[model samples]
Target: MTLLAVQVLMWIVVGAAATGFASWLAHRSYRRFLRKSRGPVSKSLGRGDVPTKLDTLIDPLEAQFPCQSGLATLLDNADAFAARALSAAQAGRSLDLMYYIWRTDVTGWLLLDALVAAADRGVRVRLLLDDVNVQGFDPAFLALTQHPQIEVRLFNPTRNRGHVVRRTFEMLLGLARFNRRMHGKLWIADGRLAIIGGRNIADTYFATLDADTRNSVDADMLLVGPKVDAVAALFDSYWNLGLSMPILALWPGFKLNRTAFRHRLARHVGSAPSRHYLARTLDSRTPEAVLAGRLHWTDKVQLLADPPDKAYGNHSAAWMSTAIADILTNAQSEVRLITPYFVPGQAGISGLTALAARGVKISLLTNALAATDMLLVYGAYRRYRGALLAAGGSIHEFSPLPKNGRKRDMLHSKVFVIDGRQAIVGSLNFDLRSAFTNTELGLLFEHPTLVADITGMIDALSAPDQAYTVSRPDHALQWTVARPGLPKLMYVEPEASKLQRAISWLVGLLPIQAYL
Candidate 1:
C-alpha cells in the first residue's frame, strides 16, 4: 500500500480505539456511582387490611360477587382518566402506581396533584416508573420523595442522568440490559380497587392533546373484586425488586423548592382548562357507578404477568405471552386481536395458520403504515402481512384521520378476544419485543359480556371509515378504502408517500426484527 494510505488507516484505527476507550471509561464511572449511591431496598408490601373509603365502598360489591371479579371497561379516554383520578382521590390508606411513561403535561400534572393530595390526607403513595423516559424529571421525582407519605422508585435506571447523549451512550454500551424495560401499567388503590391496561399517564393517552397533535385510542380496565389482590401483589413484586432503585439515591443533589412546586400545581389546577377537564371527569362518575354494582362479575378472572426476573433476561418461567398463546390455541370458533404494533414472527404466523386450518376465523386490527409511529416496526410487520392474509385471516389497518368526531390517529390498546366468550386486555402487544424482551401484565377473564364489549370496540375501530381492509388476491396485495363516497383501492401502503414506502422497504432489509 502507498505511504499516505497506510498513514490514514493507522489514524482511523487510533481514533476508533480512543473512542472505545472513552466509552468504556464512562460506563465504568457510572457503575462506580451506582455502587456508591445505592439506597436501602424497599420492604413495603401492598397494604391489604387498611380501613379506607375504597374498602367501605367496594366491600359490599365484592361480597355480592363472592369470589368473583368485577370489571368495568374504560373505553373512553375521559372516563379512563377519571377512573384513575377518582380512585386516587378516594384512597384512604395506600396508592400504588407503575407506568412506562409519565409525561409532565396537563393531565400528568393533574394526576400528580391528586396523588399529592392523597398523600396529604395520610395515604401512603408509591410511584414506580421505568427509568427509560424519566431522564429530565429527576428533580421533580426527588421532590416527590420529600413527602413523608410518598416514595419514588425507578425501574432499571441508567447511570448517566445529565444529558440525552450520555444516556444514549450508556444504553448503547449496555444494550442488552437497557433493552429489557418494564412495560406494565397498573394502579392499585388501597389494595382493594385497581386499574390496569394500556393507557399511560399522559395527555395524549387521555385525549387532552391539542387538535394539531394526534391522540391515542387506548383501553384500561377498572377492576374491583378478589382479583385486585393479585394486581397489588404484582405491583409489590416489581416495586420491591432489586432492579427498582429509589430516585433519591439516583439524584441526591438535585432538589426543587417545595413551596414553588406546590404553587405550580395549584396554579395548574385553577387554570380554566384544568377546571373544565376535571369537571367533565368528575361528571363521568365512574367510581360511583362501580360502587353501585354496575360491572361485569365473574369468577373466571386470571391475572397474566411476567415475573420480575424477566427484566434480568430470564425467560424460563411461564411468560404472559405463553399463557396468551395457550388461550389463542384453544380457540373454538373465532379470535379477534387489536394491537398497535403487529410484527408477528414466523411462530405467530404459524400459530394463526394452524388456527385457520382448523376452520377457526381470525381477525386482526393494527396500525397502518401511515398511522404507526414506529416506521421500523411497520417495516417488519409488512413482511408478515402477506403471509397472514394468504392464510385466510382478515386484516384491518387503522386510519390516521379523525373518526366519529374524535381526533384519534394512533391505536395504542392491546387486546385479544377469543371465541366470543373470553378476552385479555393489558399492555402485552403481539410483537417480539412484548413476547420475549419486556415484562407485560394483563387480565384474562371468561365473562361473555366483557368479551362482547371488547369485540364491539374492535368492530367499530375496524369499520370502513376508520380502517382499511387488506387482502391478498391473485398473488398480489391490495388495500381497500371504503370511506363514505370515497371508495378507492391501492396496491402499495395506503396514505403513505413514495419516500415513506421506500424507507420502509429499506428498513425491512435490516436484521433488526428482534428489537422491534
Candidate 2:
C-alpha cells in the first residue's frame, strides 16, 4: 500500500477509536451518577448543641419593638451597603461575622477597622471563614483574631506545606469533602440582628469604583428580624463544629476585654439580646411587615430552608432540591430565576422542559460569557441552551454594566419568583454545586409586595441595557448585549468559543459538578 494511504487509514482508525471511547465514558458517567444519587449516602455533619454562654450576649434587634417582624432590608449597592454594615458592627454590643471570603482589600480593611473598633469598646466578636479562599490573605484577618474579644476559625483548612503533596491530597480526596463551603454570609450584631446576602467582604461588592465600574458586579441583603435566630443557630453550629476554631487560639498577642461587653447582653431574661432581635424582626410591630403581611398565594409559598441541623442530614442542598421541585410544580403562569451561575445539567434541563410542556413561561437570567467569573459553569450551561430554548424556557444574560455607567453589578441574588407572586431568596442556586456542595440559607416570602418587588426587578433586568435577550434559531443560539464589540456574553444552547466549549465538555465529563 502507498505510504499516503496508510497514513490516512491510521488517522481514521485513531479518530474512530477515540470517538467510541468518549461515548463509552459518557454513558458510564451517566450510570454512575444515577447510582450515587439513589444510594444511601449519609451526609457529614456534627450535632448542634445549645451554647450555655448564650446569655452572655444582648441582642436588642430581636426585641418586639415598634417594627414589623422579619423586616428584611434588601441592599442596593456596596457604598451605602458598607456604611450600614460597618455601623451595625460598631453599634452592636456583640458581633459575629461568618463568611466564605473576606479579602484584605479596601473593603476588607474597612470592615476590619469597624470590627476592631467594636472590639475596643468591649464588644465580644467572632469571625468564621473558609480557609481555602483566603490564600495569602489570612495574616490581615488573623491579626484581628488575636484580639481578646475576637476569635476566627478556618473551615476545612489545608495544611499546605507548600508542596506537591498538597496537590496530591486535593486530587485524591477530590476536594468534595471540603467542597462543602460556608456559602453563608451573615453578620450577627448584639446577637439580635444579622445581614445575609450574596455580598462578600470585598471591594467589588461595595461598588465604590472610579467613573467606570470594573471588577464591580455584586448583590446582597441586610436582614433584621426574628429569622436571625435561625441564622444565628446555623452560625453557632459551624462555630462549635470541628470545622471551626476559636479565633483567639489561631492568633497571638491578642488583647480583648469582653467583660464590659459581655454585661451588655441584657440579662433581664434568659434570652440573649441577639436572640431578641431575631424574634422582633420576625414579629415586628409594623402591620405591613414581611412577617405580618398576608401572603397573596399562601399555599404555593413553600419555604425550603436549610437550618443548622441540616448539615448533619442532606442539609441545604437537599432543601434546594425540594425548592427546585417547587419551581417545577408551581410555575403555572411563568417562572424566573436569577442566579450567578447557570450550570444546569441534564436533570435541570429536563425539569425545565417538563414545565414548558405544560405551557409555563420560563425565563432565566444569568451572567453572560464575558461577565461570568466561572467560565466552566457557563460552559456546562452552554451545552443545554438548545434543549431549553426548544422547550419554551427563555434565557437572559446580565452583562457587566457599561464601562461608563455604574460598576457592573453581579446579580448574585439566588432568587426564584413564580407567576409573579411567590418568591425565594437564599444561598441556593440552580446548579448541582449549590444543591450538593455548599451551605446555604434563604427565606420564602408569600407577600404581594415582596413578590412584586422581585417581579419588577426581574422585568427591569430582562430589559435591554441590563440584560441581553438570548434566543435560539435552527437549534443555534444568539445573544444581543447592548455593547456590540464586547464579544458575545450569552449563547443559545452552548455556542461559546471552541476553547470554552472544550473546557466545559471536559468538566461536564468529570465529577466536579458537586463543587461548581
Candidate 3:
C-alpha cells in the first residue's frame, strides 16, 4: 500500500491496456483490408462452351439415366485417390476444388501436380481451401496462383501470414471469426463430374504413406450426371463468398517461383511410395467405367449443403444438420450412423432414444480412443455412452488395428443410413461443430444399390475383429472385443494408456463440449 508500489502497479496496468488496444486496432485494420481487397466473384463454367472429354464420356450416361445422377461409391483408399486424379487428368475445361485440409505430403503433392498438369492442358482450375490448416504451405499456393489457368483462394484466413506463433495469437484474438471453418469437401471437373465426401488431400487419406503409419478409412461418391451442375453451383457460392480472399491479394509482394515449385513437386513423383501410389491410381478403371455408362443411376439425389454465411455465425443457415435430423425422425426400421467424432448433445440423445423406443434398430460406429485423432472430442463423446446404450442402441468403436491385413488408424467417413432405403455420404459429422459451428456438404440419395453398398461397408467395419462393442451390462460399462480365440472384455477404454484415460477424464470435466 505504499505510493511507489501503487505507481508501479498503475504503470504496469496502463502498459498492458495500451498493448491490448494496439493489438485490437491492428487486427481490426487487417480485417478491413482483407474485406476491401477480396478478389472478384467468379462462377463455375456450368456447362462449358466446348465439348469436354468428360462431356463425351458422361453424355451417354445422361442419355440413359435421363434425370438421374450417376453415382459410384469409392471405399478403397486407392480408388478414392484415383477418382480425383483420373478425373483431373480427363478435365478439359475447368476444375473446381474445395477442401478443409490439403496437406503438403506425398499424395497432396501428387494431386497438386495433377492440378498443374490439368492447367497445362488449358483447364481452368479454382482451388478454395479453409485457411485453418493452410499454414506453412503459402509458398506453394503462391506459386499456384501465378499460373494463368489456376486461381487459389483461402477462407477465413488470419492476418499474420508468417510465423506460427503470431498466427496463433491472431487466431486466439479473433476466435469467434476463426473458429467457424469451411469443412465441406467438393471436387468438380469439367462441370460434368464431381467427387463429394469426407476425404481430404493427404497421404494418410489416400494410404500413400509408410505401412507403419495409420491411414484414414474414408468414402467418396463420384457423380457424373446432371446433378453435377448443382455441385458446381454450390462451389461457385463458396468461391464467391466475401470470406474467400485470393492468395495474391493476401501476399501482394510475394514472388512466385514456378520452376522451383514444379521441381519440388516433380521430386515427389520419383519417390517409391509416390510412384507405387501413382501406378495404382493410373491403373484404376473407375474413370473408364463411368465413361462406359456403368454406374448406379438414381434420380432421387438431393444436395445437402450449408450456406457460406454459416461461417459468419449464422446458425439459421445450417440446413445439413436439420435435414439429417428429419431423416432420423422419419426412420422406419433401422438407423446406422458413422463418424470419426461423436459427441451427441442432450437433444441428439433424446431424439435417438425416442427412435429406439419406436423399435428402430440404431447402430452407431465411431473411432475408439486409440483410433481417434481428437482426444478431447473423444472424451466429450464418452459422456453420452450410457444414455445411448440405455436406449437399446448398439455402439461400435473402430479399433486402430489392422483389419484383414489392412491398417486403419481412424474412421474418417461420415455417413448415415436410414431404414435400409436412403443414405447420406459427406463431410458432416454428427457433432456439435458440424451442427452449428462449421459449414458442411453431403448427398442424400435413395438409390437402392448405393444405400446397400454403404450399409454393407458399415456392416464390414462393425464386425467383431475390426471394432469394439460397448455395453452397460449389470450397471457397469465394458468393452467387448470378439477375438478369434475368445471374447475379451475390459473395463477401461480399449487400447488407451493410463495417462490417456486420465487426460480424457480430465477433459470431460471441462465446459468445452460446444466446440467439440
Please name the candidate that would achieve the greatest lDDT relative to the true structure: 3
| Best prediction by TM-score | 3
Whole-model lDDT values for every prediction:
0.85, 0.59, 0.87
Q: How would the candidate models be sorted by lDDT, starting from the highest?
A: 3, 1, 2
Q: List the residue pairs that clash in candidate 3.
A: none
Candidate 3: tens digits of C-alpha lDDT, residues 250-334: 7878896778888888898778878887876666566676344347988889899998888888767347899899889999999
Off by over 4 Å in 3: 1-27, 284-286, 290-294, 403-408, 484-487
lDDT tens digits, residue span 47-115, model 2 = 124321222222232343323334343545533354344434445356777787887654455466567
Better of 1 and 2 by TM-score: 1
TM-score of 2: 0.71
Location of the lowest summed lDDT over 10 successive residues in candidate 1: 38-47
Clashes of each: 0, 37, 0
Stretches of candidate 2 exceeding 4 Å from the true structure: 1-68, 83-90, 161-174, 210-216, 247-318, 405-409, 481-512
- Each candidate structure's TM-score, on Cα atoms with residue i matched to residue i, is 0.92, 0.71, 0.93
